[model samples]
Target chain A: MSTAVLGAMYEGIKHIFKHTFTMKYPYQKVLLPKGFRGRHLLYMDKCTGCGICAWICPERCISMVPVTDNKEYPQNPEKRFPQYWYARCCFCHFCTEYCPTGALDYTPDYELAEYDRELLLWSPERLSRPPTNIGEYQSVFHGKDGNQGVTFEPVIKQKSK
Target chain B: MTTEPPSPGISISKTAEPSTLDVSVGPQHPGSGHCRILIRVDGDYIVSADPDIGYVHRGCEKIAEYRNYVSNIPHLERPNIADAIHLNWGYVLPIEELQGVVVPPRGKYISTIAAEMNRIMSHLYGLAIMQGVFSGHTTIFMWAFGDRDLFIELAEMLTGARLTYSFLVPGGPRRDLPFGFEDRLSRLLDYFEKRLVEYDRIFFSNPSVIARAKGIGVLKREDAKKLGVVGPVLRASGVKYDVRKVEPYGAYADLEFDIPTFEEGDSYSRYLIRFEEMKQSVRIIRQALEKIPKGPIARKAPLVAPEGEATGRVESSRGEITYLVMGDNSDKPSRVKIMNGSFRNLIALPFLVRNVHVADMPIIYGSLDYWPVEADR
Candidate 1:
């Protein structure tokens, strides 16, 4: 009987020491695994917006919409961007893979936190253009069309994810 | 203000012979689906028990028939979102097998890896539920879910999606292992293995868990056969049957892992068996990841299927989930019937619960781990 109590106490100590794998997620960022698929990145010039991406989307997250009068922005009057709805997205990532042009690709960043239900909705202006890496951007500080460099100091913590 | 109605008289009449008292356990069960068990007791022992089911009657089969084949892939994931990869892969098999689409070696290997990882997550969740309901240790439950987030992170990386990934297409797996996947998976495997020992110390060897479970809910080898329990529960009862072993799918035949068995046939045995099986699954995944020969994850084919009936079954997180698909030369299937292990294994609960106390009911019911959605489908 004494041993039972002693054993229980000892086991309690051992158990506490044994279970040292507690993950602090929200506070300390978790390292995303390699090949962890997140949102879609479409290169508009490469993507024809061919309905293939829309057809292949199992969750129907991908919708090809006309650029005019869309949810995000009416930028670029001539062309339309892919209107993405994260609400219905199952993260199947089929749209990025099935795009006829190698326009679509995936990123490993998945910390997608939003407050408003409307904020969750990404318009074409929000998602249509491809994500050129900061390294690949070739002077992100420079303005487009031969203007002064898009001058900016890393002001806010830019969480591309 | 409206007054509440008075309580009705509740009494347990003791006759010269044995009499029964009814105890019902939930439609709002903490587990995945809504399932209840009604136990009729006599003097601290169960006289009879009825396994109540059908709280989640989504009519997935009926819906499957109405929806197109392409549309059905996402629809099939809802029964248990935890092991969505297994469900997606299972449904894809019949279509892939029927079409005879040539899948590369890597494509098949990737499916096996994804399916096994998803299985580990499911079993982890199940074990936590077992510990929670049987012994009332919530830390393990919270721990299991917390660790599952890591795998979910890993899953999001490979498929470019998180919860319900349509990574498995009719021809092959959708996405290839991303750059540096092998290294990341190896690290994750090491992490999962380290945690397993902690689980053993905190859960398997804990005295309270042993007292609550251990010898309770014994299933004699003969009784297990008669009851037709499947998967780890059946394996623990000394049955050497596993769908993955019997019917080799994907890279299961190529991979090597011993099927753990224990003749004790108690709730404790079931728990240990699953724990051992999880280790073996981890090993198999490591092997699959290491030697996953290079090739495309999917094959290019023309749209839609020609007419024919096909069936595919894969061991789900809960149990074996079978998909019966009928292609009608259109985008939609004629009918899709799903046979989940939880649905089938639950029928034997009434016999198991007899003579057990009302307090033991939750533990015993939870040990069997039957999901209501499996049956409702």
Candidate 2:
């Protein structure tokens, strides 16, 4: 009984020297993988106003509305684009998958918290902009014990379009 | 004080005993999910327990009727987010059967691997919150949760989302194995195997934990079979019945593993069952990864199914989950019924909590790993 108690204590004490598993969020962030289902990145050139994305969305968050901007979209003759209501979106990315023209793609921009409910809605213009807050820390296991930790490395940012 | 004559509407029973007091143990969050157990206690001992469920029910079955076959995956899986793949797979299998869709051997292997990984993740969650925190061992909770994230990271790499991975569709898995996935998985498994030894020593083998759990809530083999408890709960009671062994699905037929059972049938055995099952899950994943054939991951299945009914079952981390789907020659299913483990195992809750100390209630509840949302759904 004494040995068992001591054994448990020993295991607890051994972990005191190892690196902590948690990250300091806001200051330090773990890098998300390539195909992470976060915010949507809409491509203006590829979209043909098919509305398949709006049709396939389970939450009915996507609505194909006419682009109010004067900018001419030659690809979209009807001038229809998907406007997303982020509050209702479950982030299933079925919209991205079902889009016939591959107009929608995933962006690693998960921080979607807003102070006002109205600001949660993202227009086609807002969805077109690239994510700016992608983190650089990648999780890596090191040492003989295979203790998991994160390492910081600079990432080459790619244009969303 | 003068006793009044009893009215015609109100007749008092002479044999009625009022020694027991009824106490409600939360529709509030009881460590795991929102579930209230109405326990009738006679002094320090509980006389009986009645489970008052449906606090988190989102009507998953009814909602499946309105949504098309594909869209139903997300909400159906929401019932138990920890074991999402199994719930998703269970629902999809019936749909595939109805539509006459058979997944390729490679797709089957990938789905099997994902399911096993999900099983490990789910068990780790049970170990952390259900077993660890309930047992009052905070260390195992932290360690298990921390380790679970590693598997979750790999799951995110495979599927796009983290918890609710709508990875498996009707035909097959959504994505094929990613680049360097096998190597990374093998490395994680190696780390996890080593961590298991430390866990056994610290949490499982700890005298305090053993003392608390060893003899408490002993569900004998006969009682277990009679009550129809499923998964680890059943296995712990020396009943060697697993849906994977009895009715093989996914790549379970191809893989070789053992169903670890103990005769003790106590809370400790229940806890140990999950630990043992995690090891088996690791074995299953390794075999699946090794034997994964080179082919296309998924085939294009039709959006609609013919007018018929089909049933499919999978052994989830909690227990056996069976889904019944009826199609009316439309994109949406007419009727979808789910009979999951938590609800089936809920009968054992009130049965075991009886005649035990009030403090022992949490340990018994946790041992069952009863997710109220899944049960209520």
Q: What local lDDT score does residue B277 receive in model 2, on the 0 to 100 scale? A: 96
TM-score of each: 0.80, 0.94
Poorest 10 consecutive residues of model 1 chain B by lDDT? Answer: B7-16
lDDT of each: 0.70, 0.88
Model 2's alpha-carbon lDDT is 0.88
lDDT of 1: 0.70
lDDT of 2 at A20: 75
Model 1 docking category: incorrect
lDDT of 1 by residue, A1-161 (tens): 44554554564465444323443444444444444466666665565655787776766677777766533422334465577788888665666666666776776445557887788777766665443332111112222321221221232446988
Which candidate number maximizes lDDT? Answer: 2
TM-score of chain B of each: 0.91, 0.95
Docking category of candidate 2:
medium
